[model samples]
Target: MADAPPSSEKSFLRRLTVITQPVLTRIAHGSAPFITTFALIHLTAPVMANLGGTSLASQVMLLGREYYQTPFGEKYLVLAPLVIHPLSALLKRVLAPKPARRLSSILSVTGYTTAVIVALHFYTHRVAPTDPSPPIYAVGPSELDYEYVKFGLQTWPWRSWLGYLGFTAAVAWHASEGMAIIWNTWLRSYLGGPPGTKRSRTIGAFLGGVLPVATGMFFMWREPLMVFASHADRFRAAFSMSPFYWY
Candidate 1:
């Protein structure tokens, strides 16, 4: 009887170790973002919804929700990438034990936590699977738009707004930092082994200056971008209750 308990504990621990092995490996590498565009898109789109000027949130919300109405969402761009960024976060915490880089730790932690939170919110608050998401300019009662409205209403306060703004800023920083690392570590070598310091600083400066401008453009013009996009794909995306492709 005494040996049975110890044996059971060992068995349980052995299973745990087996399960955590892959996660630990990923965390050690933290290269999950390298394969998927989720790292950048997740940072940019959600932040715009949270911090971009007035109309920006609504546009982004519509695009995101309506994306599900189409069949493509379940594919690489929408759902797949959304799910990957956080799931791939396993490597850092499991293998590293301690965060090696402060910036990376912050980004990965916040990204993982927020991804779960957002998923939960969608699970709990999202409309029916058959529900059609309308565009931002839709009139009448919006069955598909309620979830995003709720999200925006919750963050209306100055305090909430500031917190989200800070988070978005951190996301931008983390993404830019990642790109910088890629440039320094990989791209530098490809450029015939150019001087590291000058090129790196130049690239960093360019990214720093352009992030805000790009964000502004994205925030203000999501509708136009999506309109252009939907034309190519034939997905009906609009603010009305009966959007283009509600299937």
Candidate 2:
């Protein structure tokens, strides 16, 4: 039960970190665009709702879901990036020569937090209804429209409102910053940006785009439930599946 020599342990770690850095960085960066694309598609749902109400929103959501929720898209585009990006980033940070400061950076903080929020959202929307042990038909694809969001807000006004607002803001900001980083790092020459410069304009554009969606979603959440009322028991069961259920 003697410990391995410190020098040997340190040497092994150094080799592993050095060898993995580039690979991890590539994986993290490569998966970013897919996540960002989905984020944009997600933002669109609320905007459509704002402009044309739940009817329009449901149409848009279902259309987008047809692609991302499909087996191929879910595996390669949605689930893969969702798992790979954060995991790669986390491994990259842990393996970096100086990990302490890098892990505390805005990109790192927001990236991880956004990942958690997105996972919870996916579970509530996709996993809960289809759960084999107990089905929540109120939240199922066949019965639930996009306005199930309204049901959530109505059920837990403060928690739902705050959580949605924070999640949207973080996602919007993180995605904008991530895209800017990508542009500056790889596309500066082709895209006409100075290398090493931050893109406030990109951030501004993303925030502006999300603003309407946030407003629309907030109002939509506030709107009275038109369809969810009939399935009160199932709706409650669905809400119970939310990670924020206790809150």
Candidate 2: clashing pairs of residues: none
- After superposition, the stretches of candidate 1 with alpha carbons farther than 4 Å from their true spots are 1-69, 96-106, 113-155, 192-247
Q: Clashes in each model (backbone N, CA, C under 3 Å)?
A: 7, 0
CA lDDT for candidate 1:
0.43
Local distance difference test, each candidate: 0.43, 0.75
The residue-level lDDT of candidate 2 at 34 comes to: 93
TM-score of each: 0.42, 0.86
Report model 2's TM-score to 2 decimal places: 0.86
Q: Pick the candidate with the highest TM-score.
A: 2
lDDT per residue as tens, model 2, 131-206: 5554464345756666677777778888777777778777876776677677776788787855333466445745
**Candidate 2, which ten residues in sequence have the lowest lDDT sum?**
193-202
